[model samples]
Target: MRATIALALAAALAAATSASGQDLLLRGGPIHTGEAQVEALAVKDGKVAFAGRLDAARRAAPGAREIDLKGAAAYPGFVDAHAHLSGIGFREMTLNLEGATSIEDLVARLKAWDEAHPGREALSGRGWIETHWPERRFPTRADLDRAVANRPVVLTRADGHALVANSAMLALAGVTAATAAPEGGQILKDAAGQPTGMLIDNAMALVRAKVPPPDGAARAEAVRRGAGVYAARGWTGLHNMAASREEVATEEALARQGLLPVRVENYMSLAEGGEVLASGPSRDGAGMVGVRGVKLFMDGALGSRGAALLAPYADAEGTGLIVTPPQVIAQALARARTSGAQVAIHAIGDRGNRLVLDAYQQAFAGDPAALKAARWRVEHAQILSPEDLPRFAELGVIASMQPSHAIGDLYFAPARLGPERLKGAYAWESLLHTGAALAGGSDAPVEKGDPLVEFYAAAYRHDLAGRSGPDWRPQEAVSRAQALAMLTSGPAFAAGREAELGALTVGRTADISVFSVDLLSAPFDQIAKAHAVMTIVGGKVVYEAAR
Candidate 1:
């Protein structure tokens, strides 16, 4: 039966290829329409015109240019529901320490980067996780001083919730032994009360404020470079989770210049929400960019031990820190409500998730209708208590999760949360069954932003190395079809773009992702080998892999 279908598709594609330019006619391979199986698709004026048989598509758009996909499978272009575009760009331009396996290795890499860069005002980079290190200890100022004593340096953890600064950087920020930890942040100190140069949550902001902010030109370039990277990786759209007014301006500038390769739905930062919202939500002419939501950080990440857990960590005495007090979050929600903006809160630990839920509940009391319509999200949603699991669906909160985080954090999550809490960690299938939407992302600069990596992790529920043991909780694994939805329709619905994007339906946007291998049937390990052969957005080919 499959062979007979393949022959029919070949004949149709031959007819399509025999025609000249009109728009686009894609056939000769599997086409996932996000509804049911389809033999082919046609695009006209940046929107799908036909999505059934090739003969019908040709009739719908006569003389359309044809692109035979060969045997590669095509699906709706993947959406990264949450990611940091500027950060991903900066990681490429700066000293990326994600490869360091030990404290010494990190320092050595930094020293080499410093030597190559020559005269920089300050050295700044991200992508280091202490959990994976051989020493399993956070790098201190003294350790960084060994590499460069005269200059300032701040290296962020892969989770982006914590950072380690050199003494020079700390001194510039005026962090001293007497400095008291902020209400929702912590500055780790030594036994004798000296600052240890490790800053978690809001504390990192002190040192960050001292570093020079990138200029407008640099930020514009970063957006361009980042879009290219995502396009090449098969992403047609992303919800840029953190954008300030200046960054949005840069994005608009890039859009005007016709340099953006992917679509962006930007969420203004909670801190800068008022200013960014003054002009109201902005969308570019081509719908390449939209700034209509607000992003808030409720707590730090789990890896830094600052995730505001309901119970104390198995290895530590106290629970984690709440980066943003509930009162502050409530205020942000109130402000966002006035502007009719969607809210996306970063909540990792169970306690963090509870606090955010409580805030959302309070915010929706006066306007229950908004609650259902808002489509608010809980970013990370990494660790949820059994009780809080149902509240996500009940409250209409989308769970914006990153599959790679499961693979990355699962290595040490057992040590941090112990066995019982592990049940709720990165529970993708569990969350889906609870009736909540699951929007997946890479959180690039936090992990390698690859669609295949995210899909593999979601489908297999194991680390890239496949080193999981018996207690690793494979029950949370999602099926390949579910994984694909999390990357496509799930995100499009979360962003309220389901009507226009996320499917190869007639009249929908012409965005598609063609892969070298069929993800639905690929072997677990072979999934990683699948490459994006083509990425199309708005009826234009944005990326095509070299032969």
Candidate 2:
């Protein structure tokens, strides 16, 4: 049957090529290949067989599938370099606190949720951006206690860096005033130094023990939903930032069932599971899924003052937290290096970024050959001390960043860093100028998981609140072309899959995203509404929204 189908496809391709000189000639569309000059593109078997004028493209593959683009635009299928896939799909099922600006709003939302759910065990949710409120601070434990009273409730900040829980939650987790602070974490306390519901960095582990883990079934469904959402947005693939072995297995199962709408590059939490460390990145020899690297969280996020910074936060007056101890990071890097698996270390703060870079530098012996082509990534790379920016390029580390973060976080970053420290935040243009490769991501549930939003932020550097007046040091903003590249070829290069994906070159994989609007010339605000008309992967139409 497979051979018959192939023969039929070949015949169709031959006929199409003979008649029109191409299998699928996308005539006259502005095809941005993440390269210079947005040109026209041609495709065959899901790969760009040729690109340019219609006549030339048709001549290259005569009598092929002819797609009349009618001046519509096309770009590469967005490559989200970092995102917690399962985490996003389940965000709706959890305690969401993304945009509750004030304490009253947060309490109201939780109370409503609690009332609706009735007999639910506890209140677990996310998406509370109280930093922008008139109070401009995190909610205290005393505040949370009033909302839930008895039920153990734990809510995550919008940035996914901090947690706010109630007294019941603290009691349930046995976190008390006597619970001493961990090495790199802090327990929010009252004036008398008693435990509060808020926890930062390593201190989150205190209440984390009480939150029940998602079961196998829930994980499977989350992965399924995540894949659907990705494909719906014209994403042919994703690099699952930090997932466990079970998540990998779930993705593998979905891939086997041919249910996974997008191809996933699964990185592991462990260096080795079985004898597989020596063999290489696959559990059961599935081609769609790959486990090539391990993810390590070096520090927490900046919004929560958990990112390890060189100096203390401009406002908070305290150094950011280092979630993972230096020794642990060092050991992990060494293990990952020897095991021949790539490592993606999450480092958002200056201190965290420097520490991870130092670990990589130390483990790899500063020798290119010793690292074995392992594309070590400093995920987030949000805030870098000026001195450490060059190390990303110098050490051949990939700076995997989420552009949406810049725009979203800009509302409060100025206050966090005052003015002097603002230079180090979301320095994409600086990173690129320094000859470093940038991998763009959404960070999923942390952001909206929208490629257009990321592109706009990368290109414009302005948050929704309109951080106008140069948009937070506009010099550090990347051009639209560069932004597209970061989401496309940059990540492809980081994953070592540039040869197969990323560009509209022949013999490469056929994964494409056809947009309804010209991404290069599209108005900034309208970008969010830009539609993906067609999403083809491996020469098959996975998603096609009719005109």
**Top-lDDT structure, candidate number:** 1
* lDDT for residue 480 in candidate 2, whole number 0-100: 84
**Candidate 1, position 405, lDDT:** 92
Task: For each of the candidates, give the backbone clash count.
Answer: 0, 29
lDDT of 2: 0.75
> Taking the tens digit of each residue's C-alpha lDDT, what string does model 2 give over 1-547?
3243233323322322233212466655787766644455667755778767667777877767666666677777788899888887677556667767699888888888888777647678887877568876788778887677868888888777778888888988998889987877888888898886888877888888888878889887777667766666667778887777777888887666656666788776643333223444553453467777777788888888888878778787787877776787776666666677778888887788888888888897858656536778888998888888888887788999999888777777887767767788899999999999899989888887778778888998877544554437888878888988989998788888888889877677767777777878878766767766666666555655556
Best candidate (score: TM-score): 1
User: Which segments of candidate 2 are over 4 A away from where they belong?
Assistant: 1-28, 36-40, 55-71, 270-280, 283-286, 469-471
Q: Per-residue CA lDDT of candidate 1, range 226-277, in tens?
A: 7777777788888898787777777777666656677899998877777544
Tell me the lDDT of model 1 at 320. 92
- What's model 2's TM-score? 0.89
Give stretches of model 1 more than 4 Å off.
Answer: 1-22, 275-280
TM per model?
0.93, 0.89
